[model samples]
Target: MKIAVIGAGSWGTALSTVLADNNHDVVLWTRREEQAREINEERSNYKYLPGFTVPESIRATDSFAECVENTHVILLVVPTKAIRETVQRLLPFIGEDTTLIHASKGIEPGTSKRISEMIEEELGDKKVQSIVVLSGPSHAEEVCKRKPTTVTVSSETEEAAERVQELFMNEQFRVYTNHDLIGVEIGGALKNIIALGIGMNDGLGYGDNAKAALMTRGLAEIARLGVKLGANPLTFKGLSGLGDLIVTCTSQHSRNWRAGFKLGTGYELEDVLEEMGMVVEGVRTTKAVHELAKRLQVDMPITEALYDVLFNGKKPPEAAKQLMGRVRKNEEELASLFLGTGDSDRS
Candidate 1:
């Protein structure tokens, strides 16, 4: 199959390598003509995936039309902030036969819509045949090296999810299928918020006991809001949920965790972001989640605190103190605080 991977970032490049390795015709789209020339002439994207050479079979293009033209599948891997504009740019070339798969993680600001929602709003149901989201704990750097990785592909259409699962599944790369689109997306996106919180805790010189407590409580909050938003509660225990949270919070490869670490270690958010030279998705995600929690009346203290630290000039120490000083309650009460203890709430 001919595959077009939009956004030649670390994640996009890594997946393009995998597809090329699988012997499929792969085209990677990059905004910079220099990067495209480098990928084609030098077989490397040193800025994002240093020391790793791209496969010769994977072609790189700077033109959006050339990337999507005659492709069987379109993999959207751009940042959340760019999804709308990217989709609009691709709309002219996208056909009804092409399958749309998004691997980007994060809710839209203000609207708080999921990536799928954004795609449908722009392309409409007729422009694209299927929409699938590929998500999990896998990081782009490791994935590029062909490390053993597992991730989930989800869509409302089971056939679409399975089709995507077949496209990427291999010995070194494993894929699972889930019909719960809401659960998979929520788990994949919101875990960044908890990861930022964990990074902040570590940066503040906190011990494992405190970090562990924050992770546990963070899962509860994530599960609560996910369930409230019509996701299956058990999805939080899967790769996109707890697995993603653990890896993102602990791994140095995580941009979000690294950004939070810098912030916790006495640097301002802007300075930390400038130093990273990459998008710290958790910063934007925290803002969207904070607003969503308030609008939906969901209790996400960690998300709220992280938002204050990132946007409202609240210090990490003060945010930690605020989290620690919240009202005490039993596990059931805590669950009720998020899920609402009523028959109507048991959806």
Candidate 2:
């Protein structure tokens, strides 16, 4: 198989290594010519994956035409904000029969579109075979080390999903197929918000009891919004939902959690972002989910609180206080909302 990976970030490079290990011819695309030269000559991506070796078999390129020429699959791993521009630039290079798979996670802020939706809208009249999403708890750092990592591939077409499952599966990496595309994407995207909240809690010197409460309630919030958007209620219990939430909130590898930890410790948002030097997706996602929840009349208290902290100059301590002081409600009643069988009242 010939595969073109559309980003050279940590996740993109990690996935390219996987494809090369599977003996597939892989071409990695980056905007910087210097990065491409380094990957092809020095065989290292020092800026993103320091100390990690780029497979000699996986070539690197800055030209879209060179990257996608005769490729069987185009795996998009760019940030959600760049999806539209990246698709537009790569549209002419995409083969008619090529499969389109995206590993990016995040909802668009104003448009509230998923990454797959943004790609399809940009493709317009271009005839592509399939649009699939790869998402779950797997982090790029662990994946690069060939650690045991399991993720879900989802698409409306069962055949497409199964084909992707076969393409990425290996002894070190496990792949599962799910028919619930919406649930998988939503679960994968929204979990970052909860991870931010939990990171803030930890930064504030809170214990495991608080972290457990936030994670459990965060799963409920994700399911509630997902069900309202036509996703399967049971999908939230799968790898993309609870599994992803747990990993993102608890692991130090999570950029969102790290970003939140900084915020909780009294670092300004701009300074933190500049210091991290990477995209902390949860900040952008909090804004999008906050707007979407309001438009859909879904109650997402945690998202709202995080939005205030990220955008409205609200202090993290105050946000935590507000979340803790919200009107109490029955846990079963909240679960009912996840099934789409109850009123929207948060109380």
Candidate 3:
């Protein structure tokens, strides 16, 4: 099958390499003309995936028409903030039969809408036939080198999701299918926020116990917001949810965690972001999750506390203290929205 990856960043390039390795005809489209040239010429993207050459089967193009036209699948790997803008630009070139899979994993800040929502909104009249979302714990740095990893492919239509399963799932890369788009998408988007909090805890010299607590509470908060938004609460335990949270929150490979670690160590948000030289989806995602919680009246303490640190000028260590010092309430009380906890409010 022919595939077009719409972004030229790390994940995009890595995915393009995988498709090319599978012997599929792949076209990687980039907004930057120089980056496009680098992919086809240098066979490597130094800014994103360093020291690895992209497969020769993958062609690079600066023109959307050259990328999307006649492709069987178009993978959207732009950052969360760039999703809508990027998809809008692809409209004139996207054919109806093309299946779109968004690898981006964050909600829109003001809209609180998932990337799929933005895709459908952008492709309004065109009404693309199939849409799937690909997400998991896999990071580009590892995935590019062909590390064994697993992820989920979800679509409203089972057939559409399975179509994606055929395109990319392999021995090294395992794919699971789910009909719950909301659950998977929500899991992917919100886990980054928790990873940021985990980084803060580590940077402040917190121990494994603290990190474990953050992961647990972060899962609860993620489930609360996800359920409030119509996702299956059980999905939180699946690959996109719990699996992603574990990898991002604990792995040194995570960019969000590294950024949070810097923030915890006294660097400003801007400085950390600049030093990282890549998109930190969690920072923007915090705003979106905060807005969603407010709009839905969902009580996500960890999310709320992290939001205060990121946007409200609250210190990261102070945020951790605030979380611990909050009026101890029953976990079952708030989780009542999703899991029917039999535990009492005796905390």
Candidate 4:
């Protein structure tokens, strides 16, 4: 299969390697002509994936028409904020039979739409075979090294999900198919918020006890929002849910966690983003989830606390203090809220 990966970031490059390794013809698209030349001539994307050699078989280009022409699949890996414009630019090049897949994890702030939703809205009457989401615990750094990694792909149809699974599956990269697109997307997007909070906790010198608490409770908050949005509760326990949460919250490679760590250590949000030099998705996701939770009446305290620290003038320590002082309830009672078995008053 000929695949056009519409982004040249670390994740896009790593995935292009995977597709090339699978013996599929891969074209990687970047907005910068210089970056394309570097990938073609120097075989390195040092700005994003330092010290990693890009596969010789993966061709890079700046032309969307050249990238998407004759391609069977178009994988969207750009940032959430760039999704709309990217789709609009690439729509003219997409084929009627093309399979659309997105690996970006984020919710648009005011719209609260997932990456797939944004793509569909941008697509407008242009019909595609499928809109699939590729998400899980896989990180670009580890993937670039061909380390063991697992991720989930979901779509509205089983055949579409299985087709994506076959396209990317390999010895080092395992792909699983899930029918619950809503849960997978929600889990993938919201996990970054928890990772930011966990990063802040670590930055503040809090120990493992606090980290464990935040992770556990943070998952509950995720499940709450996901279920309210029509996701299956069991999906939250799967790869795209708790699995993604655990990896992002604990890993140093996570930009969200790193950004939160900087914030916890007393750096301003703007400074943290400028220093990272990459999109720390959790900052934007925090604002989106904060608004979604409020509109839906879902109680996501961790999201709210992180939002206050990130957007409001609240300091990290003050947010921590507020989180620790909240009136606590039984864990199972909270679990029941998402399980759809709890009393209405509990919600």
Worst 10 residues of 2 by lDDT: 338-347
Residue range 242-303, candidate 1, lDDT tens digits: 88888888898998888877788989998998888988788888899889988988877888
Candidate closer to the true structure by lDDT (higher is better), 1 or 2: 2
The candidate with the higher lDDT, 2 or 4, is 4
> How many clashing pairs in candidate 1?
0
- Residues 141-206 of candidate 2 have per-residue lDDT tens digits of 899999999999999899999998988999999999999999999999999999999999888887
Quote model 3's TM-score.
0.95
Clashing pairs in 4: none
Q: State candidate 4's TM-score.
A: 0.97
Please list the residue runs of candidate 4 whose C-alpha ends up more than 4 Å from where it truly belongs after superposition.
337-340, 343-347
Q: What is candidate 3's CA lDDT for residue 53?
A: 84
Estimate, for each residue in 38-140, the C-alpha lDDT of model 4 and write its tens digit.
9999999999999999999999999989998887699999999999998898788775688999999999999999999999999999988899999999889
Q: Candidate 2 at residue 161, lDDT?
A: 99
Error of 4 at 296 (Å): 0.7
TM-score of each: 0.95, 0.97, 0.95, 0.97
With a 3 Å backbone cut-off (N, CA, C), the pairs that clash in candidate 1 are none
Error of 1 at 179 (Å): 0.6
Computed on alpha carbons, the lDDT of every model, listed in order, comes to: 0.87, 0.91, 0.85, 0.92
Clashing pairs in 3: none
